[model samples]
Target chain A: MDNIEKLKLTCLHDLHVALGAKMSPFAGYDMPIEYAAGIIGEHNAVRNACGVFDVSHMGEIGITGEDAEFFVNRIFTNDVTNAPDGQCFYGMMLNDEGGVVDDLLVYKRGHNDYLFVVNASNITKDEQWILRQADGYRLCLEFMSEEMSELALQGPEAERVLEEVVGIPGADLAFYTFKEIDRDGDTVIVSRTGYTGEDGFEIYGSHPFIRQVWQALMESGRATPCGLGCRDTLRFEVGLPLYGNELADDITPLEAGLGIFVKLDKPDLVGGEPLRRHKSEGGPRRKLVGLEIQDRAIARHGCEVLSPDGEVIGKVTTGYRGISTDRSICMALIDARYAKTGTGLSVKVRKKTFPAVVVPKKFYKKSYKA
Target chain B: MIRYSKTHEYIRVEGQKGYIGISDYAQKQLGNVVYVDMPDMGDELEKGEDFGAIESVKAASDLIAPVSGEVVEVNVALTENPRLVNVDPMANWIIAVDIADMGDLDDLMNQEEYDIYCLSESH
Candidate 1:
């Protein structure tokens, strides 16, 4: 039996099916996993040329009011106070125990207005958590998930596609910055940001406006219509953490090797104390590291990571036959003792144990616009 | 005679030898097969047990054995280019097994029955 009752539909659902996309249930939404070009073709297109993804399934929450900055800083790990309007900061919201509640992109749209872009799967959890933290803070919460749609235009040729084909002229925006512009009488938020390790932009707008943009990009025949399949590969190659895989409710940013995003020096964040302690004392038991398998077989998620002596150290968080780098690599959360570079490790893939070595988590270098 | 299992594995028997692979419907559902993990030629495969895995870009699914047998030959071409499975799943059989129990064929569905079974499953 099909489990379509609880599953939501994205705005591009009909369009995806029209283009012969392989639809699958992801994060409670019937989303496109790939198009007719397939994952490999779509993945290579984003690395070499331009590709667009209907990331409308992602959740958006807006926080507005006087205490927006202070209140957000109290819950979020990144130092967003120093960031000016139009600046986007990537960080996590953590629980009191230093475990990640969710990792999100915080966009400061105005002095009192902030937009939080979070993973689709964590929408309800994140909203509830934020509502709980909004008790004493002077803020108004607006869940903009259903009303908004997002498109990620990524690759080396993304800027050209956006400027000429999509007709959104915010290509001049610096990386990690965004601006609201009038597009055919509709206000659209265009951010010079992406998850694919390539130079790209993320456009957030109303469903109608997003639909128009999607159609234009599709009709231009330049931007490949990518799916969540290639999106995972692209992000994994660049070592970006997917919430469920890398940053779970029990996993802290420190353990996930995202310490730079955790602004512990700032006083009184929800999970600050525990994260600070971890930073100061090296308290995290496990650390995230990259492992290169010596064999052709991929070491998939949940595979056991072991020491040469046969002791289970950790497990693989994410793995791929990296489309960009062309290597069978995986990021594993292993014991801190064996997380160093060049450390000998092995991953038990099904029956046979394959030899591996600890390498840097960044399997492919990012080509983000400076 | 070719028989299809409820698990989507198909076995084509030629005397004592049987060539095994996932059904075309199963391959289409998998989409853009990237890797096909198979047991070695000498590995024993029990009925209804997972022999290996097939990986697509989005996920990996275990390939189950429809009948008890010992792996006699594996399709080596799939190791170099796994996309062959997606191109033609029937032509790109995963392994050839020496049938341990000829009676196990009765447990599977024939072409006509399997077609009806797949039609019901889709709905």
Candidate 2:
């Protein structure tokens, strides 16, 4: 059963192979790691112009019926009921222990019909958790993962590329907002949201149509083909926390420094009480902070972060050294005392003690379309 | 003379001394080489073992030794300018070793063999 319930493939899986993309397992699909042009070329391509990503593996499930808003609001810690139509709110799906099940986006298409954009790897878990949450509630929920393909066109030139293929001006779409555009009698919800910290749009539609759109956009937009390698580095540069690295079943939003998106004042929501108490009284024993090493040594995940006196403080969650930065920068969940803007520390990588300093990150300030 | 190991490192061997670095194929595969973690000059290295690390924009990889030897020299330029490897990997040998395992070179790729290997990959 486990082997049979293997990872799913997107419509562009064939294209990835044809383009000589080094494929690897990500989320639930055999996705590309890098192309012949390599990750650096892809990373620089996105940073300079536009890059097209086959993010079709991301899950899209819808919730409907009259009590949909009420049901979603109760399950999410954020004020889901507050968003007007065509707006998306970023929030988390939390377990009873106040740890994040997954960080997701809630799109309010209508008062009753809404979409939940979730991480690809957690689709099964998210779907099951939602079903359990809705079983005793008054809402009709549906997992639309089988019915949709999601694609993201990201980079500084995302708007230009998308506008060319979609044949519609998308520059007006505000951040975290979506519009149902007519594309040959099919409505694809195009949202001005992306994970690369660049101005981009995510389009959702049927499998075949999504494939056609990918081919069309790749041709007309002249976007560089990017794979998981560039995607991970780009997202990391922007300080986005990946689920497995920064978020765990035991990792709270407070520790991840994502509490701004979690609303404590919300009524009738799961995990709000503990989160509120955490907010007021401080429950985050450890907090994620960005570290810019003074040297070239890369501090890998799980590397020991030590105090000046050689006491263990925390561990590196993710580290990346890029040509653009010319130095290694790491993110570690450390005690709040050392998480200050300029606290100096040490990272024990292998047998060497590399000098580390805390710095404000989102390493590349977002250059998103307004 | 350019020689390569299956693990992707290449060296220009001459007598008891040689300059070492990754092959063009390896550098091309790794993408925009960024950081290189070089061991101190006197550190010992074993054949087929990791001597240090090389970071590309996307990820970091360990640098494996093609021959067991004592590290008699290192390219200090790498600590400041890692692009030297990406610019001319053939020219920038990472280490100067008193190769303890001289016979190990036979098991690695000579320039002609490596050239054919790269050619096959294109097809």
Candidate 3:
């Protein structure tokens, strides 16, 4: 109800139905929101063991040309030039005012070649922006959202599961790093990265190769196919932001506590001075904070947050009762004064207010393989 | 006389007292009812006002009052087996109330009339 209908189904549509997933519309895709095994079961599965996801709906764009790193480094807020070949760096593209354009993963294929992993909804917009910027530079940028099918094998046992399928002991790929392995002795890229706040690899290959890879990985990992419903809660448990919820066009990275990724001191970069001003000016008016409700009342998105004495502060961005924690928790965008840990607060559930406490952010401590 | 509201609440009037529950349509639409909280005993409710709420895995929706009344008795069965409403919502009344306004009766629909109303929502 918080979003509109923008669903576009992928190759796993019938497979999801056959497995009894509850389908829902999300990010211009008709996706499996969850399996009938439920969000709790799916959520715990990804947290404890391993799980598979048909994330082919996410967008990917490629850049090639001389000085490609110069063009990419000029654009994203992340320090991508320092990222060696066969590795990825999480960063965001920003507007002139330093508001987030989109948060993405930048993969450096070589000195002058790069790949951008962007959110599904921003594919068209990001392509247009990248192409417009490419006009002056000697870079060739291409949107490749359709060329790859993304599958996530996430949990503690991710490496063990993938080693048998990838057959190369990809366990050597460090966190935020990737390697190309042999599929019939031909290379396919497997990156040890994830969005579910778990340890895993996101596999990318040709479309035909994905089906067999999916079956083999699922069989080897013994991971159940998790839907986006559990995916949202799983990520939220560890305080990883959703595209619309945490990273939006109007919200600046400084405001979202994402200033860590932006290197304002870098020489002659895009959006540098503006970011410097935000950094020096004591950050934004609102900051993100974690919350725990006293009651089982779920403080969902758009719910108003107030002080214990009823001073209105802000609103909830995302919320859920953790199946792993067995506690009702949420994250909110509140006045900087209330962002402190252990501040007493209240959330409006329907018509009544329930007491909650501002706890630490990243409620679930993720132990990914480093 | 038994009556129903367009929003899917059912009421059975016995003298000045009335019993309230949700219709089958409401329960079916809200799958796998996880929790229910009804109006407190002796609580006053205005016609069409929220008197209770039902939460499911998917989402949550409130139970509206069919007629103005003072809540007298509530079904404790909902606490343990809330899904009973989806199976036989009409027979499983959630609240018994003392009617606060008799004039509101004209706004309610009988079973056959309510079925026609439910039909309009069908695609």
lDDT of 2 by residue, A1-370 (tens): 3642486778888888998898778876889888876887787888888888888888888899878888888777678666689998888988877888988888989988889989988999999889878876667777888788988888787888777776657877999999887777887888999888888888888887888877887677478888988888888888999888888888889889898888776767777777777777856778899999988778888899999999999999988884356568888989888888889999998778988999876777778776
Q: Is candidate 2 or candidate 3 better by lDDT?
A: 2
> Which clashing pairs does model 1 show?
none
lDDT tens digits, residue span B50-79, model 3: 986876644668889989888999898886
* Interface root-mean-square deviation, each candidate: 1.5, 1.7, 3.1
Q: What lDDT score goes with residue A125 in model 1? A: 97
Assess candidate 3 and give its TM-score to the true structure: 0.85
Could you say which candidate leads in lDDT? 1
Whole-model lDDT values for every prediction: 0.91, 0.83, 0.81
Error of 3 at A48 (Å): 1.7
| CAPRI band for model 1 | medium
Q: DockQ values for all predictions? A: 0.58, 0.68, 0.23
- Looking at model 1 chain A, report the run of 10 residues with the lowest lDDT sum: A1-10
Least accurate stretch of 10 residues (summed lDDT) in model 2 chain A? Answer: A1-10
Give the number of the best model, judged by DockQ.
2
lDDT of 3 by residue, A158-248 (tens): 7887876645476679999987766766447789999888999898876777777776765664877888877887888888887788778
* lDDT over C-alpha atoms for residue A362 of model 1: 92
- Rank ordering of all candidates by TM-score, starting from the highest: 1, 2, 3
Model 2 has a DockQ score of 0.68
